[model samples]
Target chain A: MSGGLAVVGASRRVRAAHYATERPRRPVAALLARRGELAQYDGPRFGEAVFVTLQAIDLTCIRGERMIFSGLTFSVAPGRALLVRGPNGVGKTSLLRLLAGLNAPAVGQVRWAGGSLAGRVSYVGHLDAIKAALTLRENLAFWLAYRGHNRSLAAALDALGIAHLIDMPTRYLSAGQRRRAALAKLLLVDAPVWLLDEPVSSLDGRGIEVFMVALRRHLAEGGVAVLSTHQELAIDEAETLTLGRNP
Target chain B: MMRSLWALLHHDLRISLRQGNASTSVVVFFVLAVTLFPLGVGPEPQVLARIASGVVWAAALLAAMISLDRLFQADFEDGVLEQLCLAPTPLPAAVLAKALAHWLLTGLPLTLIAPVLAMALQMEGAGVVPLILGLALGTPVLSLVGAIGAGLTIGIRRGSVLLSLLVLPLFLPILIFGVGAVEAAINGLSARPHLLILGAMLLAAIVLAPLATAAALRANTE
Candidate 1:
């Protein structure tokens, strides 16, 4: 409760410098090199939309008898990301669901440019949601078609390094591979906002690097992302918001 | 929205095809349960013919129940239900697609096969067409009404029994009319009244069940 706001006190530039010094140069360079290959992918960008914003005010979430978190507020504009960090059972996923309009908040409001998040946000939760019996190609194609978006399935699979496994059933994939396939849905949709919960949990180091590249490109296209995680995302200029139990 | 609904329907059909066992189990149960009555009773045509319509109708009701619990549970557990709720196409429309797909896999097959099974049970010639027609108009109502039960019981563990409890009472009208139509034809009376009532129930179910199922799904997912 004491240092929650202080977590966002550090300037974006200062935090970027701190993150650079915190990581080893060799792997960082390797990650950057991999990201460069994925940078070529350009899906439908939300560029022309004048105002794309997500805001939450006095948000509160409760599970059973416990009040998980309360009095939380944050905002993410186009070209920016909001990173929610908290320990397990602190309502990180609940907050993301609230913003996604999947769950309503007990108190206060979550607004997206004065409208609901429905139809404008693409959400990826803890469960991969991929049909194990379906091939990766079919699964991605279904999601793209469901969202009414005509994005390239081949490029999305290629960017996620699962192009080789496209024709294989998702059941044969390892946990990390399955997670990467799920993450590819974000790239396949044309939504203005992305609400991801523990999106990197099962991803390997290389998979994380690919995801970072996709996320960066998404922000560059004037799309907003709000994700919750316990680990560092290492994205420069991303806003940090921490939630905890109120005393 | 139309494209999304079509996509969901196609995707659900593919999944049902891949699973394959659910529909097969329902059909197998329908055949086995229908076959049992003749063996349990004497092989006399009088007895089998007397009870043929009720036995087949009852068995069909149970068979349809076998797959009802599965209508929304698979998608709910896999997280696809949430994605479906968020889709630009209205959630009720998606529910309709899923229910229609469910009917195609479960009810439609039962309708086609019930007549064959009825003939095996020594059903008289008079009851033959009435049995097929009654089933054709009735099974879709089972699927539609069963979806509401499936949605309401999704969060309960070992909910199959509860699903039956919730939906069986609603299924009585369909079962009554289905068996009644065949009985009337066997008795040399016109079966049109009963068949028309079954059709009316199907029409009402098609219009209303999707809305109830969608609401229940929203409550469970939230």
Candidate 2:
């Protein structure tokens, strides 16, 4: 049984090598023959317009004695989303936090629209900022007021499909519902740049779909979103910026 | 900026009022502390009366300190502190607004209730008015100073004890003058100097403590 398993693994490795080498070299006619095989492969497209930019920046973060990430440089422009993919403990959230201006980068500068992304950005971290004591409507109202948005809270809640939960205290809401409320807060704000740290972490499949739809709307409206996610998001024309792997 | 400050203050006040337990607990603790003093030290009416002003002021300060940890713990846990820091309003203004709201909920009620507690402890009627007034002017300073401690210890695991240890020493002058003012009033002397000094301390803390607390918050976050 062990010998048979080893033989199968070796044959599979050989097949993978052959497929990797020959796939890119096939002509359009040959590719047409493998359309069914390629149908399942979905990834983001590159070379869209530039929305936001981070120059050759050195972000030296020290949580006691560890340097999280250093000399990280990347930029995402309009019509392009930077999907920060990295293993846990690779400072993915720390990078987003730095970009959001919540923590100052030890030695780097992150600029949006040719300037610091201070006032023109919205950040939603891993923790839900909702107050358990306040109803969803009250939480949204407080955030909107804090962001100086004079829009209709009812309309915002309606857009997120959270109008049903508007009067319920956020603590009683499910994880997906809490996430939706937080995303609603991001949408209600009028900022151009969105820094979302694992916005879909606790979301269900339906919740993920709702987020993708909202994100697509934001991208369509010329707003930019940067998020980190472990789950594959099959958004059309989205770009992935893998951190830690390159360095 | 002022609008943001006002909004934060209003929001915090509304939340505290709706919750109702934190402020009530602080007042209840204040009363318990005052009552314990008469019980523990013997209920000689003359002795209680002689020490009533100091007893009430010390109990009020201790009660205020007991609830200082709650001032920022809930907001910090709920991520509201991060939101406040990120708001377009200046950090100092936001911190000042939160501290002011805390004073309104905790300190203001203590001031209102201290007179009754003082009377029960056999305090002179004339001293009771000055006791309330002194607390009115002095407890805000305590709140502001205590906010600095709270901000400094925002994320520390064992922070409440450290916060009291850090703030109580700083609060001695306010307590001294606050109780001193009432004692003078009880003695039929003008308490104007002590009251004015306590007011000055309040004004100074109101101006300075927010800046210190904002800096402390920034340092802690960093």
Candidate 3:
């Protein structure tokens, strides 16, 4: 029994180490890729092409009479991800909300792709952002139409493995399934920057794996994501931005 | 932009229809409220006729109000409203589409049933058309205006009552115009002016109410 307990403890330590190592690699890889792309492009071509850049300039957010955070600053380049971490109620979500332009910052700005973040970035919060009355298929279709994606709904649903639930009302879905359905909306959209708050909250192990894969694919395609999550994510490369503390 | 609006309208209407009981509940409330007048006041045909237009319209407004609180509450709770706010199309336009859908689901049915309830109250046949017309134009305004209240009270624990308090006063003008049109038609006077005013109100709401609603939705959601 003691030996078995030792084995379990070792595994947990290994997993924690793996998790710690996994976070920073994503942004390092992004920087490397940017460097590689820059090398491939001649000087003029690199100079002329526009890349979407996200910069949170000294942001402060207040929620419910409490100051969540202040003087938070960070920037994410295209093809990168910013993993925000903090203690509960420290305002990781509020910071994302401000960065996503859902709410005004008490004092600062979140700029996107060389412009104001407004109308440019997509923000997904903890609440799956799905309508229970509509079928999963109809919900995706409506969001696609609203976002002006002009993409095929079948492909998006298939990507999320929710093609089977296409006709099912969203209220009938399990928590993990509903999160997948919500993630499917992100697939249908083509926004350059994504601000996701606790996106993996209800996802299962397999669901989290699938989400990581999807996110990697998104980054590879030059999309930027800033996600706040407490769970350790296994990504090939990522970076952590701890809020409410100087880094 | 227009396509987004149409899609929002289509999706919301389809959901309301498939939900079955929700649409019926609002209509049933309208009927029950209309039925109570005769029961309470004692069914005298002349007495019913005298108060029928106001009673039916008031009941319809109250029933419509009952359902209005749910317009954005469910979406807000389920996080769908966040996705909507994130859409490329402006949030105000989407909100207008939703308000339009709410009118179609809750307000439109109430308008359709008004004539039947009016007849039960011994309202003159000629007045029924104007009553329906007034409701058609007026209820959308009620929905659009009520959306602002709904948006404001979203996520509040006691939002339903707060929604009623905030919106009922705003609904008074619509109530006055709707009942006035029916009364004008009953008296064989031209109801066109009242109908025109109702249309104007609807147009103004279509333009202004959505902005207010979208702002409120942002505030409440944040």
Q: Please name the candidate that would achieve the greatest TM-score relative to the true structure.
A: 1
Q: What is the C-alpha lDDT of each candidate?
A: 0.81, 0.75, 0.78
TM-score of chain A of 1: 0.80
- Candidate chain B TM-scores, in order: 0.97, 0.96, 0.96
* lDDT by residue (tens digit), candidate 3, B54-163: 99889988988998888998888877787777666889999988988888888888888889999999999889899989999999999999999999999999899999
Task: Give per-residue CA lDDT, model 2, range B1-222, as digits (tens).
Answer: 666677677778777776778788998899888989878999999999998998889998999999898877887787777767766667888888898898988899999999888889898898977888899999999999999999999889989999989999998998899888998888899888999999989889989999999988877765
Q: Which runs of model 1 end up more than 4 angstroms from their true locations?
A: A1-48
**Alpha carbon RMSD to native, model 1:** 9.6
Which residue runs does candidate 3 get wrong by more than 4 Å? Answer: A1-49, A234-237, A245-247
DockQ-best of 1 and 2: 1
Candidate 1 residue B161 Cα shift, in angstroms, is 1.2
Kept native contacts, fraction for each prediction? 0.68, 0.29, 0.71
| Per-residue accuracy of model 1 over B27-120 as CA lDDT, tens digit each | 9999999999988997999898888888999999999999888888888898988888877778888888888888888888899998898888
Model number with the top DockQ:
1
- Residue range A5-75, candidate 3, lDDT tens digits: 10000011111121122123223324535667334322222221222456677777777777767766666
Candidate 3: lDDT over CA atoms? 0.78
- What candidate 2 gets wrong by more than 4 Å, as runs, is A1-56, A245-247
Is candidate 2 or 3 superior in TM-score? Answer: 3
